[model samples]
Target: MRIAFYGSSLLSSYWNGAATYYRGLLSQLAKRGHQITFYEPDAFDRQQHRDIDPPDWCTVKVYPATDEGVRSVIAEAALADVVVKASGVGVYDDVLLLGLQEAARPGAIRMFCDVDAPATLAELRAHHDHPMHRVLPELDLVITYGGGPPVISAYEGFGAPLCVPIYNALDPETHHPVPPDDRFRADLSFLGNRLPDREARVDTFFLDAAARLPERSFLIGGNGWETKAMPANVRHIGHVYTRDHNAFNTSSMAVLNIARDSMASVGYSPATRVFEACGAGACLITDSWVGLEMFLKENEEVLVARDGVEVAEHIRTLTPERAREIGEAGRARILKEHTYERRGAELDRLLRNVAAAKRERSAA
Candidate 1:
């Protein structure tokens, strides 16, 4: 199958957290002999700070941040067997959606992939005049990043003909354990862009934990965290590249997962970091969230912390032997059920089903 994806930056993990997710899924799909082309706009400073070059498996075309550039992309994308316009494509989301709807030819499967389903659903519910509500009926399918039942039901209720979830999973080839790098060595580490929805949780779970355990070395990696005042023990390493994720995780004794408010409320939505940490064979400590156990077993595979005190205790008291045991268990679980190949196979099945159903409808 030929697939075209219009998403946030695929070559840069700069401010775009979805880069890893896209790279994992699409690269896996390409490995399965599917032709994939990714179209990303040269906006949001992504091009300026790109951490990765063009991938070997798939073609990535970076377009100008102009109207004509988007129109050209839509025209090219409309010719594919499947075209996906993901949420949070920086400034051109509405324009791309409108153009995609106009340009898509008959029998072309057009999907709106919502990487930020919880926030998207919340906005659609709150604003009756939301543009997406007007465009929902035009889409062939709506796929999400695991908001579970609530997100699926809501999208369907809002006139999405079909809604499905393609959960985030680990890519072992990119994320597996490697020799630890001394530069990123930490007693506890957290790596994520400082988004508005996630800052509070980061403060409560990561920063406060650092404050409580002043003697323990804590590392924070990602852009937009340089200005924040951190504890003396905490080191802020701005914008760790995707290539260094394995080293970043391996160097840390334990890694922290702090979900955004929308994600935590929706449950069943594990951050990409969770899967990466597991793949890297790192002991994991995550803030409490609904349906977390669905991904990793609490206590046995991962430690759950309700507050800073719990995070501190987990870091301060967890023995090396116990940490290794938990890390190994988590890695095993991830390998068994949550790899990119698993997700790619699932997506292949789903797309085939959608195509078959479309054919049946056409024949009728």
Candidate 2:
């Protein structure tokens, strides 16, 4: 199968949280003999700050963030066996969504892949005339990286024929345990770009905890936080590239996972960082959310906290030996159950089923 995916960016993680998710799933799909062509617009200086060179697994088509640029790519993408318009492309999303549907050849499977399903669903519900409402019924399938049952149910309610959730998983080859680097050494570290929905939570879950535990060292690695207020114990390292993520995870005694407001409220949504940190054997402390038990065992594989106070308590009492125990357990669990190899196989089956169903319908 040849898949043409229109997404944010695959070569860069700068201000784009979906890069790792794209690389993990698509690379594995390619390994299974699927041909992939990733189309990403050059915007937000992402092309300037690329973390990885063009990958061998896929052909990356970098287009300008202009009307003509998008049209050219859309024409090229229409030739593929599958055409996918992923959410949050950051430029001309509406044009791409409708354009792909019109431009795709007959018998080609059309899919809308949502990396942040919770937020997307909220927008669709709030606005009845949203483009997705019009696009959903026409799409062959709606796939999400997060939001387990809620997202599936919501998309179906919005008239989608089929909706599926493919949760985030570790790409062991890309993200695994590495020797701790001195530059990232800290008691607790968090890596996430600053955004409106997530900033408040970051302050509450991360910054407040740092203030409470004055003696503990904390690290923040992401863009748009250079001016953000923080405690003296906290250090801000702007935009840690994907290459340094292993060191960032391994150097920390523990890492944190803070969900955006929508994801936390919707529940069952796990960020890509969850698996990455665990894959590197870093003990994780995450904010409370529903359906987490479906992924990692509480206390054994991961530690859960309801608020900043609980976060402080966890850091205060967590022993070095215990952190190692939890970290090792977490890594083992992810390696056994949640990896890109498993996700790619599942996706391959889904795509095959969708194609078969289309053929059956056409024959009927």
Candidate 3:
């Protein structure tokens, strides 16, 4: 099958959240003998920090984010059996979104994959400020990377015909435990970009824990953190490349998972880092969430941190043997339940199903 992916930066994940998601999903789809022509806007820094170069197996076409872009994208999308207009492309043009909706006019199975389900839900619930409200009803299927219940309910409430949460899964070939690099080595490490909403949670769960444990080495990685000062004990490593992520996980005594306010509120959204970290056999200390047990066993595979006290105990008390056990269990869970191959298989089935449905409607 031919698939065209339009949304987010497919080539660059340097500081982008969806970069790994795009790379993993597309590469898996490619492995299944599907032809992919990924369309990314030229305006973003993705061109500057292209992570995975377009491989020989697929076509990666870059277009500008402009009036001309819509026409070009529409032209390219026509070649696909399925075209996915992914959410959070960092574009402000609703018209182009509408255009992508229309380009699926005759036969192609079009979809709006909402990676930011919690954010979309928050905005849609608001009903006025967000752009997604106007676009949801017309979309054929709304797919999400996170937000299991709250997101689906909200989308269906808004009159969406079908909505699904794909969730985040691992790609084992791409993510696995490796020797720790000196650059990422630390007692406890946190990697994520800063935003107005996420910063507070980071402070409550991460920074406060760092302050309480000045003796333990802590590290922070991600962009937009240059201005943020921390105790001298907390090492600010700026941005760690995606390639270095496994080493970062392996090097740490434990990796910290800080949920963005949106994901925490919605409860089912665990970031790619969560899977990536665990896949590397890293002991994880994360903020409490509702559906986390479905992924990791609390106080076993992962430590649950409700406050600075839990964080301190995870750092100060858990012995190496215990930590290794936790890491191994987490790794086992990821390998069994969430991997790129599994995700690819799931996606493969999904696309085939959606395609079949499209065919049935056409026949009808």
Candidate 4:
């Protein structure tokens, strides 16, 4: 199938958290003989900060952040077998959502691929007049990167015909163990764009932990944290590019995963960082959330903490040998069960089934 995906920037991970997720899944889908054309707006300085060139696996179409640009891309995207409007396009999202639905060719599979399902669902449910409510029934399918059952159930409640959760998985080729780098060396490090929904959690899980373990070194990498005050032990490195993600993960004794408020409340929504850090064989200490056991074994493959105190305790007690043991176990588990190849195959099967069913319906 020729899949046209409208998403956040794929070539840059600057402020776009979904870049790795898009690259991993779509690249694997392309390898399976599907042609993918990713449509991203050249907004948020992403075009200037591109970490990777247009990949051979998929074609990237970077359009201007204008109404004309949206129309032009939607018209072209309608030609594909599958037209997907992913969440958080960062510009004219409403126009893109409704426009793509109306513009898509008849019989073409129109999907809303939501990267942040928990938050999206919250908005839709809280506001009956939400634009997504208007678009949901028109969509052929709803797919999410994470949010296991709660998200599926919520989307179905909104009268969606079908809702599927394709959890985040590791792209081993892109994120694997590398030699540690001096710049990133720390006892515990976290890499995520500072966002409103997640800042409080970061304060609790990362910053507070750093304050508690003042003697130990800590690292913070990602954008939008330049002004946020932190302990003297914490080093703020703004926006670690995708190229250095492996080193950022490998150099740290432990990496932290802090879910945004909505994701943590909804449970089961694992950020892309989880897979990337674990893929690099980093001992991961993530905040407690439901449905995590389905992805990685607690204590053995990952260390779970409920609060900053727990996070501090984990860092204080975790020996280098033990961290290595957990990291290796996490990496091994991810390679066996959560690689993008596995995710791509599963997605291919689902897409084929959905397309076949649509064909049967049309015939009927």
RMSD to true structure for each model, in Å: 1.1, 0.7, 1.6, 0.8
Cα misplacement distance, residue 208 of candidate 3 (Å): 0.3
Candidate 3 backbone collisions, by pair: 170-339, 170-340, 171-340
Which tens-of-lDDT digit does each residue in 179-234 have in candidate 3?
A: 87898878899999998879998888888889999888999999888998788889
Rank list by lDDT: 2, 4, 1, 3
**1-364 in candidate 1: lDDT tens per residue?**
7888999989998889898899988898888788889999989889988878898988899999898998889899767888889999997888888777777778888899899899999998899988898789988899887798888889999999999888999989889989999999999999998999999989999999899988899999988887898889999989888889999998988999999999998987998999999999999999898878788999999999998999999998988798899999999999999988999898888888899998999999
Expressed as tens digits, the lDDT of each residue in 1-364 for candidate 2 is 9999999999999999999999999998998999999999999999999999999989999999999999999998668999999999999999999999999988999999999998898899899988889989999999899898888999999999999998899999988999999999999999999999999999999999999999999999999998898999999989999999999999989999999999999898889999999999999999999999988999999999988999999999999899999999999999999998999999999999999999999999
Candidate 4 residue runs with Cα over 4 Å from true position: none
Candidate with the larger lDDT of 2 and 4: 2
Query: How much is the lDDT of residue 162 in candidate 1?
Result: 91
- For candidate 3, what is the lDDT? 0.82
lDDT of 4: 0.93
Error of 2 at 65 (Å): 0.6
What TM-score would each prediction reach against the true structure? 0.97, 0.99, 0.95, 0.99
For candidate 4, lDDT tens digit of each residue in 13-57? 989999999999898899899999999998999999999999998
lDDT of 1: 0.90
Alpha-carbon error at 315 in model 1, in Å?
A: 0.9
Give the runs in model 1 whose Cα sits over 4 Å from its true position: none
What do the candidate models score in CA lDDT, each in turn? 0.90, 0.94, 0.82, 0.93
| Residue 285 lDDT in candidate 3 | 91
